[model samples]
Target: MAKFTDHDDYIAAAPEQFRPLLGQLRSRLAEVLPDADELIVYDMPGFGFGKSIIAGYAAFSKQCGLYVSNAAITAHADEIVAAGLKFTKTGLTFSPRHPIPDELVTKLALASRRELGV
Candidate 1:
């Protein structure tokens, strides 16, 4: 595999299994941050608004990650943990076989935007 520095490259480099999910996640992100500028960052898809450091999405062999860059994500760490969130070399993610709850995602996005000063 080739080294990728941003999201587009990462998407391109990712295997077939990740393509569809990656696209779905990307669409969801856009829906959440419609006006935000989007690009590839940290070898993953990132959405930026007033600032560049914002949320992102990335997929791996096991599952995909919906990155909420705000420190606020920690506030619900306990709940997420109970719901199966965990520390990974990358970040938090749901298991490959599990579907992320829409309600949880809404909460996370709201928290993330608040952290971003949105």
Candidate 2:
């Protein structure tokens, strides 16, 4: 595997099946927070605004995830669950074969930005 020195590298180095999923998630996040900085943080592709993480995404062997804070998930658990995606304390997971909803992505990203007040 290639070393990931940055967000785009991390996405490009993901499994071929996961690349599109990661790209879609990245694009959605960018749409919501165009000023956020893209970074490879803690081994995942993430966005930051003034040192606060706005959003992130990663590819696992069987799933891809959109990562926000635990605070964001706690505040919006019902809405996230209603979207039929599985979210842990820190992020939401979905199969690469199934594209996650763009609206839900935008909503969650905006909520995260609000949480950070950035």
Candidate 3:
């Protein structure tokens, strides 16, 4: 596995099966936060707002994740859980095979950006 320095590098280094899904996720975030800086934070593809990390995503063997804090996603808790996805204090987890809802991803990323007051 290659070290990733940017969002594109992170997505490119992900498992081939997950690349497309991760791309969709990254696109959604970019749509919401066009001004945010894309970088690797906590070893994942993340967006930075000023000095704070607004959001991030990662792929694993069994699942893919859209990373946002609990406070950032609280507004969508019910909908996230209703979708049969898992939302912990850290972020949301969904099956890589089952693509994450684009609208939700946009909303959460925007929420995270808002939380940063950026």
lDDT values, one for every candidate = 0.65, 0.80, 0.80
Query: Candidate 3, residue 14: CA error in Å?
Result: 0.9
Runs in model 1 deviating more than 4 A are 1-9, 88-90
Model 2: CA > 4 A from native: none
Error of 2 at 100 (Å): 1.9
Q: Which runs in model 3 stand beyond 4 Å of their true positions?
A: none
Note the clash tally of each candidate: 1, 0, 0
Model 2 lDDT at residue 93: 88
Full ranking by TM-score: 3, 2, 1
Query: Best-fitting candidate, measured by lDDT?
Result: 2
lDDT of 1 at 61: 75
TM-score of every model? 0.71, 0.87, 0.89
Kindly list the per-residue Cα lDDT of model 3 for residues 9-48, writing each as its tens digit.
Answer: 8877787888888888887788788888887766777887
- Write the candidate numbers in order of decreasing lDDT: 2, 3, 1
- Top candidate when judged by TM-score against the true structure: 3
RMSD of each: 3.2, 1.8, 1.6
